[model samples]
Target: MKDCENLATCGFFRKHLEAKTLACQGFIRQYCQGDKQDDCKRKIYKQQHGVPASDDMLPSGQLLAGHEK
Candidate 1:
């Protein structure tokens, strides 16, 4: 489906638009215009995954490393 169409159907998007929140409208105006689907994808990915789409926010730690006294 197209990005605009997908966004229009999103529950969060629809709710925010219906509520007429300034931030939501601004975001839609900025990222949901024309062919910039990646913006929507990243937003949705963050919503579903509970983290930023990029790796920068991931927790830093050594795998299987025990506590060091």
Candidate 2:
């Protein structure tokens, strides 16, 4: 499948795509540009809430390390 339609504008990708952490980058690879894009919590939350989740929200629906925003 193609990459996510929201890749360019996704809050998570725009904010964290450049993160040096392997886990962070892995999330991007696993969701933003992979087959799992359809399951991204960020996309799901946006669809459900009509707004983006917090910047610290991972595509897996978890918060970033030490981050609860």
Candidate 3:
């Protein structure tokens, strides 16, 4: 999908979900431990599951809508 491709360009959808999740939990990124690829995989997972995020952000309770993860 064009929309998904666009979101992937800057990793906005990818980072936004991670950022939102962290923000929701009040994480301050106090450490430098990194796992960039995993985050991307999450985004892809969200996508394949038909989440509502720009790329694929599962809704609060939908858990990826009608799709299985």
Candidate 4:
């Protein structure tokens, strides 16, 4: 395989690849064996929208805006 000078310009670099950048797939398939499906789906959402669960916030409202689906 040819090396890419800039992966952004490489045709082999797919959009879904960003989802795997944080080792999220392995994290789900391994530690979260029972809830792998939900874990994987959440990771994919985070990758696409850059939204993380705000556990530190108050229960009534969100600190950062993101669609809750």
Candidate 5:
């Protein structure tokens, strides 16, 4: 699987990667840089809405607490 093409510009990743949380890293490995890239909720939300999801939105589609922007 290829890394997600959107990684460079993904707001969620840019915002959360600073924390370096294991959960965030896991999500990146599982969805952003793995076979599940196509299944990423960020990709799905953008594809379905024609706009990027909120920066706090995780790859799994769950919003991170206290990270809203």
Candidate 6:
């Protein structure tokens, strides 16, 4: 499956499937906008660690294997 497809099945995504709150909605929106991808290091870290990402986390070039980019 594609990276985004895999992300779609993650527990976090599932939990916020129908949420209208900013955090949940923003996650979906950013993901759809291609902001969360292999090129986005913060997203890669969040996906690997299952942690919530923050604006303070800066982007890097490293990619997390097996994670949705």
lDDT of 4 by residue, 19-69 (tens): 453443343234234333333333344456666323222111223234131
Q: What is the Cα-based TM-score of model 3?
A: 0.20
lDDT of 6 by residue, 8-69 (tens): 54444554545455655565556633456455555576678787454333334332233332
Question: Quick one: ranking by lDDT, best first?
Answer: 5, 2, 6, 1, 3, 4
Q: How close is candidate 2 to the true structure, as a TM-score?
A: 0.85
- List residue ranges in candidate 5 displaced over 4 A: 67-69
- Candidate 2: tens digits of C-alpha lDDT, residues 2-61: 889888878788777665477778988889989899999999999999888887889999
Using lDDT as the measure, which candidate wins?
5
C-alpha RMSD of candidate 6: 9.7
Q: How much lDDT does candidate 2 score?
A: 0.84
RMSD of 1: 12.5
Every model's Cα RMSD, please? 12.5, 2.5, 10.1, 13.3, 2.0, 9.7
- lDDT, each prediction: 0.46, 0.84, 0.35, 0.33, 0.85, 0.48
Task: Give me the displacement of residue 49 in model 3, in angstroms.
Answer: 0.3
**Candidate 3 lDDT, tens digit per residue, 1-69?**
112233444333345446566532221121111333334443455567765334333322123333222
Model 3 lDDT, full chain set: 0.35
TM-score per model over all chains: 0.43, 0.85, 0.20, 0.23, 0.87, 0.40
Worst 10 residues of 4 by lDDT: 55-64
Best by TM-score: 5
Which stretches of model 4 miss by more than 4 angstroms?
1-39, 53-69
